[model samples]
Target: MSINLEQIDELRKRANVSYEDAKNALEQNEGNLIKSLIYLEKQNKIKPDEKPCNDNTFFKNVKSLIKKGNETKLIIKKNDNVVLNICVTLAVIIAISAAPIVIVGLILAIITNHKIRIVKKNNEDSQVNKIFDKVSVVVNKVTTKINEELKTE
Candidate 1:
């Protein structure tokens, strides 16, 4: 088969090889682009492209997120005293493993006027803390109603 300049130029750009090598690979592979790449690879003229986001990269990103979570803290305070302090990651594990217990504890804390705070390592504000603030407002209203009912009874 006859080789054309376009085919040679395309191969050269793809393989990052000289004009002569591209033309030769194209000629040997009968102008097939995929086969020319394989031929150049077999001859060690071009290196294979690395994936931008492979398994290793994914795992690295997960590790980084976990690390950041560990650096953040979940704090429960009662009467201006810290009652419970734990890493955000461990708190999540506990909350997932014992969801009922976590819910009960949160309710009791809310009833007892304990404060829940998510503090980051750098003391920066988090949207999660804002969520907690909103939940606290709702729980406080419910608890106040319950207290009034108990008093009435």
Candidate 2:
């Protein structure tokens, strides 16, 4: 059986294989383009389009964030002793629901020589750690500025 130059060239270009391999494939498949392509694929001479792996990074980050939140603690102290200890999530809820109450408590704590501390129980390096560290730095700066202002007043 004879194979045409065009068929061989087409198969060679489509399969990204050498001319000889393409000719052999076309001849073996009786000059059928689709069958020759399939034959090349089956022989591992051509690679099929690959699908991407499922990325679950977002879900992993969310899970880690939740875990970090659970492990975070807000401790209110007076005279080097813990007066109140609560998880970060609960503190946030209280702070949000009763903003003025929280502010008053903080001001009173400052006036009475009390200390407020945020403690992270988890020590693992993660995306959540980066976010929490940045937030902590900002909060610390703001708290220090407020304390300075209050002291001067």
Candidate 3:
């Protein structure tokens, strides 16, 4: 099939390829404009309908979520009355610093009929709550184990 000069020029302009490359693509694809474009794309001489990856909204949202998680409050209550309220980061620090105390406190809370609730201060979404729920489950398992061991002894 004979490829015209106009077809080569148009392909060069659309695909951002050199004159020789565009002409070669047209020749290889049997003078079909669509197939020539596909050939150029396959050869990495042109990008085919690509969306820009410059959007920073995803990163911004992740940063905001991290900030929100840091600001989230953990409220410890005894008999429906608030005993302690601290941010999640601080709670994590305290838990790390006083692991034994934290475990003993949880056990005591269980015995004294206390409730622990994690609350997100600014965000209405449940992302932070979901994380806290997982943490609470782990804590509950540890406390239950400790309770069992105490009973056995």
All candidates: TM-score: 0.63, 0.41, 0.39
The true-versus-predicted C-alpha distance at residue 144 of model 1, in Å, is 3.2
What does candidate 1's lDDT look like per residue over 103-140, in tens digits? 99988887777888989999877787788778878888
Model 3: clashing residue pairs? none
Per-residue lDDT of model 3, residues 127-152, tens digit only: 65565456666767887898999999
Report clash pairs, candidate 2: none
Ranking by lDDT: 1, 3, 2
Worst 10 residues of 3 by lDDT: 123-132
Provide the global lDDT of candidate 2 against the true structure.
0.78
Q: For model 3, what is the alpha-carbon lDDT of residue 56?
A: 70
Clashing pairs in 1: none
Candidate 3 similarity to native, TM-score: 0.39
Candidates, ranked, TM-score: 1, 2, 3
Q: Is candidate 1 or candidate 2 better by lDDT?
A: 1
Q: Which structure among the candidates has the greatest lDDT?
A: 1
